[model samples]
Target: MVTSPEEMQNEANKKFCVVVGNTVTGICTTSNAPADAKCTATDPGKVTVTSVPSDHLTILGTLSTTNIIMANWSKAMWQSVVNRAIRMLAWGPLGSHFFSAFATVN
Candidate 1:
């Protein structure tokens, strides 16, 4: 007979398998998960989900605007960003008039 305790198990009551700290050892939890999980040195890009009753917010995407005024505000913010980028380019070794040329092209 063989026993493999390393394998993760999510029973009806327990629904999460998460590493506590920097160690490879993990624990199972039945408690509610945080809104955003923490990242560790070993796993810097991913997070561990403690519990999930349902897949409600699995596909969170970009910000969305519904009103006309908010849409215009977004456009204004984007234009400002473009202008700033152009101004920064003007300060580069190219020349001080780079922003003017960029403004004309863009």
Candidate 2:
């Protein structure tokens, strides 16, 4: 999890590329990311998945929906989502970016 602003900035600088299935969809770089991408950082706590049927079903459903959305997305749509994720990571409060990223995709 990210702990500080500097570390967050470093992560942003890593220029990680988004991949969907076998295709490289979008890249996160200092150039393409928003100007305020490194404003703040917060650690998003981890989740432990117990061997529960409900949890398994939830995960499976989420994964299935994600696959469908990703498969239907155009290159530009993927880029827009990626860019929005970067912007949220940069400007939103702490771990809020994660939700923003997925929410935008939906």
Candidate 3:
């Protein structure tokens, strides 16, 4: 569980939640995770599951759909580093330099 997805994105630049589907899908941010289960982050029903901190991620069924969305423990801070990187690239030198030099360094 990530404390703040927004901060993570700005600082780290990666998707906060894996949003796995089919019980557990597309949550392979860490190769250690079951990459074989590359399911999309689609709605996997409305079942409430307990979100486990990365510290407790080793526990079985720790990475559930509902739990991930509604948990208190946060192991790693999530963000949109990948997407932001693409955006920075798309913006070219102009966007990168503009934001880095003038943007608020929160």
Candidate 4:
């Protein structure tokens, strides 16, 4: 799990591969929040998983409600994006072998 903001900052310059078996058809990065992540498949599709930045939060009143609302919206948006990406890949030319690699990476 992601721990610090510095980790996310460092990940900004790197591409974390999304592996299915031995194939790497996508890359991803974690956000400032531990539970948040974003992935971009080679099929040119993207997916995001959102999370609340608890570091910036307090046990407040209306703010908590707002945060919950925002989190829900983000979750919905993430699901929609991920679904679109999956649908695109499922119908794309690379879908069948996207998870199968002919060679190994050292």
Candidate 5:
């Protein structure tokens, strides 16, 4: 995990791998990733994937939302938002399932 600004910069400099059919097709960086490739990173880690080749919609959705949340909210604030959401869903029939599926950052 990246623990400092310098580490984050270094991680950003690293090339992202682009694979197809169990074989690597190319390598790219944040600035040059293909239009179809979605790349996202937080202080802790990064994720990159080709949108068309991958069928993991849940992963894509989580990555997108997590990136947005981390970009806009501090840890404490984010936790508060999550807690509020949990509370709001507490009375629902799907409360347990929602809580289990909800993502939280450490």
Candidate 6:
């Protein structure tokens, strides 16, 4: 039984490669987790699953679904960084110049 979110995601990572049945999908990589559970990926795509924490109890015979949202965690993170940089530029004296530079790269 997994006690924390980290352990839960680790288990999910092991199963990520199996999301597409017996075929190998993407290369599995550890990434950010969900608010309530862990998330991992395989190949170029990610497969997310939710698990009940060891400290939490659930009734038997309940159905649980694993919804795979197609979003690149790494890309999101970099986008966040880029947003912050833009904000900094907008707030500073050199805001216009740097903001234009960053925008042009997009």
> Which candidate number would show the highest lDDT if scored against the true structure?
5
Tens digit per residue, CA lDDT, model 2, 1-106: 5479887666555444444565444553442244454322232221111232334222111222358767887768866866875677657775532333333233
User: What tens-digit string does per-residue lDDT give for candidate 4 at 1-106?
Assistant: 7559786566553446666676554445443323334454232233333343455222322212347655566655655655666566566776774432222111
Residues 4-100, candidate 3, lDDT per residue (tens digit)?
8665443432223444442332222322222232323233431123343555333222233357554443433222333454467458665633323
Q: Give the per-residue lDDT of model 5 (tens digit) for 1-64.
A: 5389776665555656676666455554554333333455432333433343334323323323
On TM-score, the stronger of 2 and 6 is: 2
The pairs that clash in candidate 6 are 26-42, 26-43, 27-43, 89-95
In order of appearance, the predictions have TM-scores of 0.23, 0.26, 0.15, 0.24, 0.27, 0.23
Per-residue accuracy of model 1 over 51-99 as CA lDDT, tens digit each? 4333532332355568887666756686676577667766766654232
After superposition, candidate 5 runs with Cα above 4 Å error:
1-70, 92-103
lDDT of 3: 0.36
lDDT pick, better of 1 and 2: 2
Cα lDDT tens digits, model 6, 1-106, are 5379877666545533323454333333334433323233243344444443434232223222354442334556556766786678777776643314343212
Give the higher-lDDT candidate: 4 or 6. Answer: 4
- Candidate 5: 10-residue stretch with minimal lDDT: 55-64
- Whichever of 1 and 5 has more lDDT, that candidate is 5
- Kindly indicate the candidate among 2 and 3 with the higher TM-score: 2
Model 2 global lDDT (CA atoms, 0 to 1): 0.46
- lDDT preference between candidates 3 and 4, better one: 4
